[model samples]
Target chain A: MSKIKVVHYINQFFAGIGGEEKADTPAELHKGEVIGPGMAFQKGFGEEAEIIATIVCGDSYFNENIDKAKAEILEWVKDLAPDLFVAGPAFNAGRYGVACGTIATAVQEELGIKSMTGMYVENPGADMYKNKVYILETRDSAAGMRQAVKSMTAFALKYGKGEKIGASVEDGYMNQGIRVNFFEKERGSARAVKMLIAKLNDKPFTTEYPMPVFDKVDPMPAVKDMAHAKIAIVTSGGIVAKGNPDHIESSSASKFGEYDIEGLCDLDESTHETAHGGFDPVYANYDSDRVIPVDVLCDLEKEGVIGKLHTKFYSTVGNGTAVASSKKYGAEIAKLLKADGVDAVILTST
Target chain B: MVKEIERAGFPVAHICTVTPISMTVGANRIIPAIAIPHPLGNPALDKDEEKALRRKIVMNALNALQTDIDGQKVFEG
Candidate 1:
């Protein structure tokens, strides 16, 4: 019988503040105000729910000072105590998606409020925060604002009203790996047979379970003149310094290790071992070089096959690790390698 | 991880025993290794022979990195 109170969050551009030029603007909370996409959401909510306030922050400002920005926004959301908090359907704007995810997740986790945002499935923030919070998949840009607002507002009202959320595909949200049981008109065997028949007949049939889609990246041009290139080694075989200094997990590694191998020609049993539990560790432990090939790489460097061997090698366990986590680590390690002026990388996995 | 590095504009040569997984994960350049546990080593061989085997794999990986390609490729090791 009572209207649900809602708070909306947006980036400076969406708030009509400005674009990249005004991306340094700090957080601003407009209490009792509806701005930009909030208007669309307001219309979608109709009389069932009301947008109580809109919190806007510059994407750059939020990402650059993430802690301060999150703290500031958290205080505002807690003060308003809205039944639901909705951030942007940020789509493909990388930093905006991250900001939305951070604030939305904080509102839900730190304030015990229902919060959600929407973004493209491939956005870095989507991978980082999808499991931590609800993220509705949106088109790659704001051009989908109308459809995004419609779906987001519907989900917002349903969740705000304490209604049970449906499966991701049914509700149009990214899959968070939560399974809900429901009865269907046909049994699984019947569905399987139907699919088989359709496949044999070369007919179109939707699969009950879809394989994960991987983003294909065009190959970067090959490194020219290996004789003058700086090469680095990275491994998912979980090789680490003796005693596993960083304590990299034996499986489903949560973090990667960066170790300096300067002035070293090889990784030996006493100096290094593997943390990978996926395969037998005896061979790799007997000679850490077995997994990382540091010895051979050093030999190549000595022979002038490469101009230099980067001093640092990154290591992480891939066994059972989430694709999201791997992608996050890979991106970070790539940044570090680029900063070090490394020209190429050799990545080994088991 | 291979795709991430390549996506960032760095040429990456992925060395793994499973070429299909490498291709599935969008690795542009790949070199098959000796085995899963000892990707570069053949423990059954004498230490010197094993080192030679590893050298061959490493050489293949290096070559893969320097060979330009428009799409995914698996090179000989």
Candidate 2:
């Protein structure tokens, strides 16, 4: 059989293009050759699979204009005649991983092609798209480059040969944490019996597979009277003073600031600016009212729909903040709101 | 975000464009919004339509606050 053709997708950096400045560069298809990391994969897979084309675009370009990027990239790959597609070994770069995962999953879904990418476990992109494609668990840095490439190539070769691929771990990919029915070496009854026997014998027994534990939260005491409840408006949109006096970091914010707007009816660009770096800053800057909508909430409060508006609005940047940090911030904000006798909160996110 | 807020001891409701994700993530109550960026109002539309959509969703959210449910409840009218 002839060598299976493959196409590789990579961000601008990996394609020898510059950083954010080149982020808007449109998708380009290079035929008959492998780019940087593709060469490594090609070497590993040998002639069993050949990278016939390389599609490169900037991370910001794809993120900002996802539909256009997807259209252009898919159109480019349509003519490449690739049997398999591969995206980045995106290390711990969140944007790169997201770009890779998005494109890989899209190609797999839309074009019916086998697609694979690699990302670290902590990369949010993995959690978002892992269920849709083969995502190899990779090191935080490129230290695992050789091994990652080799493993990805092995899976690609198997896909090209139409062989039965095993579980994610067995196939050298991260588990998406979804389960499917598959024939097992041991029966369910036998496994259960063994576990029971071990437990009765007072021996340590591990579950065959442990389910993820979702922290159960005790429900809050309901407000006695909705009409008498003091409602507060809190936002993770990072609406801070123009200079960001509290110095909240854009993405991974460690601190939250409460701004007093006691006499103010509305927040304007001169008074507030977005510390959120995730979305376009233009809209939030020109119209701080859009992100927070405190004016609307205040109007409702004046209508006696709520008892009182909190004197201070809590603000923080939500983008790329870990769940743990977010939880901590939530608890802190809750404590403050509770102390002030605020019965309810209307929190918004951009 | 709504889950974290509710978990912190407040009856919380989420006004989100993606109801499926919020519902799956165990949001106590959900009110569907227009889109991700402009959840309440759509600048592209005329002021009347924008107000109507916002009013409808906001009302639904307020209604969600008053009602009790056994599990994650999505407001649909």
Q: Please state the CAPRI-style docking class of candidate 1.
A: acceptable
Evaluate model 2: give its lDDT: 0.75
Task: Compute the lDDT of residue A249 as modeled in candidate 1.
Answer: 92
Native interface contact recovery, model 1: 0.86
The stretch of ten residues in a row with the least summed lDDT in candidate 1 chain A is A120-129
Model 1 Cα lDDT, one tens digit per residue, A271-329: 99999865668888889899888888888889999989999999999865667899999
Models 1 onward score TM values of: 0.55, 0.71
Q: What DockQ would candidate 1 receive versus the native complex?
A: 0.32
Task: List ranges where model 1 is wrong by over 4 Å.
Answer: A212-350, B1-77
Q: Find the candidate with the highest TM-score and give its number.
A: 2
Question: How does model 2 score on DockQ?
Answer: 0.27
lDDT of 2 at A106: 87
lDDT of 2 by residue, A1-350 (tens): 99988899988878888654465577888888689898898898786878889889877667656789998888777767578889998876666777899899988899888888997876767777888898988876677788778778888889878998887757878877777787879899998999999999999997768887675553454456767777776777788978899999988788888898776666677898889875556656765666666666666677887667778888898765766787788888888888888777666665
